[model samples]
Target: MEIKLVKAIPGDVLLLHDVQTRAFQPLLEKYLDYEKNPANEPINRLFEKIQYSSFFKMVVDQKCVGGIRIVARNNSYWISPIFVLPEFQGKGIAQQAICQVEEIFTKHNIWELQTILEEQGNCYLYEKLGYERTDFEQVVNDRMTLVGYRKIKN
Candidate 1:
């Protein structure tokens, strides 16, 4: 399938919000991470992110399947909440999107992200993409923890 990362515009906020909520809903229900779950966030928060961060729609075969948000500072970049719809999971869309975003930001040498530690698939994906797990972690709930990862490009 053809995959592309299209820069998000303000008009795409509702679509982004919808896709994000749908993509993260199962996780939200599983983890009950109301405060930290994108599915639980308001549309306004997504609008703000679109305005402030580099948000891209993960388009596959001309359809918007998911999104990735990047927060950049100098040579470092933070990737938060990259997701694919539940139906679209296990297809490597998220990995392709991440690689495409990194290609778009070629000047950035450091990439950072966080994922649910309990979700081994998520951890495996990031590690497969060359991200090294850091010591930093946030315990979200008794059943969930967020682990930090960083990739330094040389």
Candidate 2:
């Protein structure tokens, strides 16, 4: 169960998009977050993301199980999206991936991300990983809200 994060290349866009869609589909269906769900994003959008962000393939035993997208500015880093396929979730892959990404960006002292406020599991995972909830919250709909989190390393 070796988990690895490989820098994604442009040619990997289609595969990454497919994995992203599969990973986010259940959440999209449950939340009906049509405008913000990565499941509804076009392949071209993912391709563009690969060009600008530090997109990495979440590989386990040489198989691409999911991906994580990171945006960096100065000493801060933002993890916009991180997902594992439905079948791959709960295997601690995402946790390991996040740790690895943070290690890879050793110079970064501030890390931030957002997740659905209603999803306790998601919030718990981030909290367990040392992310503290920020006061910021975005109401996505009547049923869903996005909450921000941040972790600062000393």
Candidate 3:
């Protein structure tokens, strides 16, 4: 399948909102009350992310299938949310999209992100792409575990 990562424009905000809502429903079910999740936020907040972060649309076969939001802080880039629609998963879309994003941020030496502990696919995908699990672990409301990952350019 053809895949492309395009910088999000103002008109794409609502589309991204729908994708996030659809893509993250499973995670929400798994983590229940994942209050910090961008998917759990409102569409207006996504509009804000568009202004403040490097947001992208994952297009596959000429159709928007997923999205990613990365925020740069100091020397590292943080991926707030990288998601692919449930139907288009297992096709390496997220990896391809992330690789495309990495190409644009070559000056950054490190990339970091977090995923819920129970989401094995999300964790494994990052690890397979060379990210290592850092020592940091965050507990949310004493209910769920969030694992942090980091990848340093070598």
TM-scores for all predictions? 0.97, 0.96, 0.93
- In candidate 2, list every pair of residues with a backbone clash: none
Position 152, candidate 2: lDDT? 94
lDDT of each: 0.92, 0.92, 0.86
| Model 1 per-residue lDDT tens digits across residues 1-154 | 6588999998999999999999999999899999999998899989999988899999988889999999987779999879898989999899999888888887779999989999999999999999999999999989899999999988
Tens digit of lDDT per residue, candidate 2, span 24-65? 999999999999999999999899999988999999888999
Candidate 1 residue runs with Cα over 4 Å from true position: none
| Candidate 3 lDDT over residue span 1-154, tens digit each | 7688888987898889999889988767766766786568888888988887889999987889999888899999999898899999999899898788888888888999998877788889999999999998988755578889999986
In what order do the candidates fall by TM-score, top score first? 1, 2, 3
Better of 1 and 3 by lDDT: 1
Report the Cα RMSD per candidate. Answer: 0.9, 1.0, 1.4
Cα error of candidate 1 at position 44, Å: 0.7
Q: Residue 127 CA error for candidate 3 (Å)?
A: 0.8
- For residue 153, what is the lDDT in candidate 1? 87
True-vs-predicted CA distance for residue 94, candidate 3, Å: 0.6
Q: What order do candidates take by lDDT, descending?
A: 2, 1, 3
